[model samples]
Target: MTEACERPEATAGGAADPGDPAADRLEVRAAVFRGDDGDRLRVETLALAGPSHGEVRVRVRAAGVCGSDRHVLDGEWNVPLPAIMGHEAAGVVEAVGAGVRGLGIGDHVVIAWHQACQRCGECAGGKPWACTRARSNDSLLPDGTTRWRDAGGSEAFPYLAVGAMSEAIVVPEFAAIRIDPAVPFDVASLIGCSAGTGFGAVANNAEVIAGESAVVVGSGGVGLSIIAALRLAGATPIIAVDVSEARLDEARLAGATHALLGGPDLAERVAEITDGGADAAFEAIGRVQTMAQLPELIRPGGRAVFVGLPPEGQKVEIDGLLLAYEGKTIIGSNYGGLVPARDFPRIAAAYRAGMLPLDRLISARVRLDEVNEAFEAMRRGERTRSVIVFD
Candidate 1:
């Protein structure tokens, strides 16, 4: 488990990063979030290093601005201040840590945030999402400290252990998944979070049957990804509900058979559209009210898949009578039931064959400096996914 991670490039003040060209140390840029100052901005001159034991140093190329990052930006989920926030990313393997296998320097890969220790009971039992060690481990180098530092000699943390918004980062080898060479970093970046989670919802959690009808609440990147998976699953009536017309249109393009503008009493509208109830319903926005209505939309014995994570500490409203009478199953899905090694490649293959329209899902692509703008766009509901593309 001992790994000698890349040393922070030698620079000024004998700082950790000495190789940044801008500051005579390692050149790194990232979208950082700070709660105390209500600060969310792009930070340049952040220094990074190569991987340590079981780690891989990635020279990040592109990172998607996912809803999860938006959650961090608003301070709903508290991350350590000065933490690099972007997680759904794609990059090149700049270096490999000791004991790292199946990857090498110069390899193009998509960054995965959830890393599991294989020996754990959750991992051995096929539920790596429930990895017991995820919450406890810091996922840093062999030492207890980090590989990144700011100009003032302050330690900086990467979010979810990936932090792909920066120029380069040292992270666990399991966080980097090799992607097809042909896919652009922008497109492949979706594999990092939006695509992987969305596709996994229907395919893995719901196991959607062909010709079954489905309703998806919220049509952002994740919601639309669910539509795409349902389409490939041969689901016939793919109804997309959203507050935004643009997202609904995106959902339609992703294979939604019908689009409904979300209104007050959304469940009532769903009941009317589906002629009493849908075969399955997906709640992607993560609001209690929206999640609460899932039972009302599904047919008896139908499944309601909760896709989005509501703000931290928010409890979902549940009606016991409706569930008991309807025999409906309400479930929360994390990372779309994603098993990275198997699902990541399958999603890439589908995208390569022209069946999955990932390129269309991108509303805008900006540099790291524009990350705040991306978050603003997400807040205003102006775009589906604003991805960060680096050089």
Candidate 2:
């Protein structure tokens, strides 16, 4: 873990003044994605402005390399260039800006990519997961601006608002959720995105009841997380499918009752295991073919939860007639329909309690300079989750 920086005295409300020049000009090393195919991520020294109003500065300890980040690297998701491309991370608060209440310097935190505007209708209606204002693709902060700049002073965007790939970052107070210090940063980092998303999909979106049957169509980090949550939810006949035998073994370790290799006959095999079909089928891989096969893998009234994110502008062609005839529901789970402030800590607690095998999800730990290699491992289906750990 990175040592917390020297704490600056807070003002009356435990909030640091944003006008401090020293705070405004903090420099940090970050893995930058310039959107060029030849140069995916280059380690560079970047200047970061300290926490502004309703924000906090975090010294990142560990950041996970996710498939969503891979989407941007593969040119599937078009995000702003020269951005810090990471969202799943755990760190410690180094400074607090004006009006920051729930967090203070030295508090361990998990960075939430979706920093919902609490005043929005979706947030007010108790569905911050569907917040209309938190744009993950924009790469800009909630206020539509960036805190990072290059050596030549070119503004750089935080890929998904939190930008955990950097050594340090400034994010909205809501984006930094406090967690138990006992949890390891590397394990806690997966909770920020993959674990939280998977658990939320089961608890919030699918609402899988005890004895319910579920089939997870991917055994990657997020897929393994879903399998774990399904077990905790008391689901039965939990089947996991993936192309890699290694990930299938991981799925079994994460609580999959059965593991199967993904192929053209995947749906047929899942049906054979669950009698007619599973009560719920989760598509964790964002491929069109796998997503389209979800309906076939579930029972008549079963729900198909789309937990994986396909490339932007890509559409899946599900059989509308079949869906209507069978009364099957398709749910789109964004960030697993998670409310970060409420769910991140709960996930951390689960991890500490041994309810979730989060540490097993990390297949490789690399430094910031080796981020591209980690992503390549992900591309080759050789990893469950790769974390970039800072010194």
Measured with C-alpha atoms, the lDDT of residue 99 in candidate 2 is: 65
Model 2: residues with Cα > 4 Å off, grouped in runs:
1-23, 37-39
- Lowest summed-lDDT stretch of 10 residues in model 2? 1-10
Per-residue lDDT, model 2, residue 336, is: 84
**TM-score, cand. 2:** 0.94
How well does candidate 1 score on lDDT at residue 29? 71
Each prediction's TM-score against the native?
A: 0.90, 0.94
RMSD (Cα, Å) of candidate 1? 5.5
**Which runs in model 1 stand beyond 4 Å of their true positions?**
1-25, 36-39, 136-145
lDDT by residue for model 1 over 282-335, one digit each (tens)?
Answer: 988868788877788888889999998888898777889879998989877988
Query: Could you tell me the lDDT of residue 22 within candidate 2?
Result: 48
Specify the highest-lDDT model's number. 2
